[model samples]
Target: MKISTTSSVLALAAASTGSAQTTTYTNQSAPFTLQIANSANASLNGLYLFSCHAGAAIEGICVGGSTPISGASSTFYYNTTDTDVSGSDDGQGLLVWNLPVSGLPGTDHVSQSAALQPYRPGTNVVVPLFGFDAGTPVHFDDDKLTIKDYYNDANYVAGQFPDSTPAETVYNNWYSCWTGVGGGYTYEALSWVTAGVPHNPTCEKIDVIRTFL
Candidate 1:
């Protein structure tokens, strides 16, 4: 059952920089749904490291939620970096990505301040996201790649050993928003998170890498 794919991304309007790019979420699944609880969420592939064999020339990772444009999709870049991700965990300082979904039109919580204070914890909201390799294959500048899932799965109880804590008590499901670079989980590249509110039937399907170019 071989099928053809197209670039699901777009060369979003730019000022004609030294390069170009497109991004998308692939729809190879049975139209799934992910519920990123208040402090817990995740993606399908569980990919921590994102890479782009888009030549040596660096490019920027463009991540625009329901807004027109926010980050650079042509100059910023990161590829093959490592990310230790889980299915749960949402912490402060976590950069989440936002894409439009079909059943879930209209996105929310779009701000244009570099202060990084979109809103109070749990103030913002979004629908489920469909992962993809939109448009063409190229390098992105990734100034803010923290836009991945709800936060890394911090299911592990934080405490001292020996006089230890109970690990068999709670069936934990999530973690925090630790960077994939150092400290917590180590990812190989860049990534983003697509989450929706709690108990809400929010589902969406944006441009997936319909067919790989």
Candidate 2:
């Protein structure tokens, strides 16, 4: 479902002078949690989006563990050139997330200067891609944030791809995945599966929840 940001929230979208007029929604002060939605599996419905570190790569994963680390939250911002007016979904814009660094001991190897972006490491191996300043433009439709593409807006999908070379699973059900340390199969990455693409049986369409706190 689409969560409408209030006029006050629109006030947060500041416009800057440039060749392309842009409106930016910065939600750092009002972080939100992205819970799995539209899933038939009851257990999977409560999973929340989180950041996971595998080797030197930081990726997005969904987990349902009971711990402070499981409380990971995120804030996002999007830039639209459609119009300078705030709160208007005039057109697709660059969507970026301020993903929290996983607090798992010894796995917090991400340097402070690294740039993170949404990426797929391999087939069905979607993770938080690093070393990029920007990602593809995305927009919200019917209250769900999605990737804005030429064909159509793509919904975010989460699932366990057991066929993947290493067989990934959601971490702790709490800790981040570390190669060769029994953490390998701990977490599965979130992927932006485009429309008309064949999805696995375990894949479920998800809705992002915008919560205050």
User: Candidates' lDDT values, in order?
Assistant: 0.21, 0.37
Per residue, candidate 1 scores C-alpha lDDT tens digits across 1-213 of: 111122121111111110221111111112111112222233423222211122112221222222222222211112221231221222112111222222212422111111121122542322111122122211111221123222333454567333234332211212222222211223222222223332212221122111111
Model 2 agreement with the true structure over 1-213: per-residue lDDT tens digits: 112223332222211111113223222123445555555555555566554443323334445442214333233344454344454554554444433334333432211111223333432323333222333445555545554433311332456333323322211111122112112534444544433332334445455543434
Off by over 4 Å in 1: 1-120, 123-151, 161-201, 204-207
C-alpha RMSD between model 2 and the true structure? 14.1
Clashing pairs in 2: 2-143, 59-128, 169-187, 169-188, 170-186, 171-186, 171-187
Best by lDDT: 2
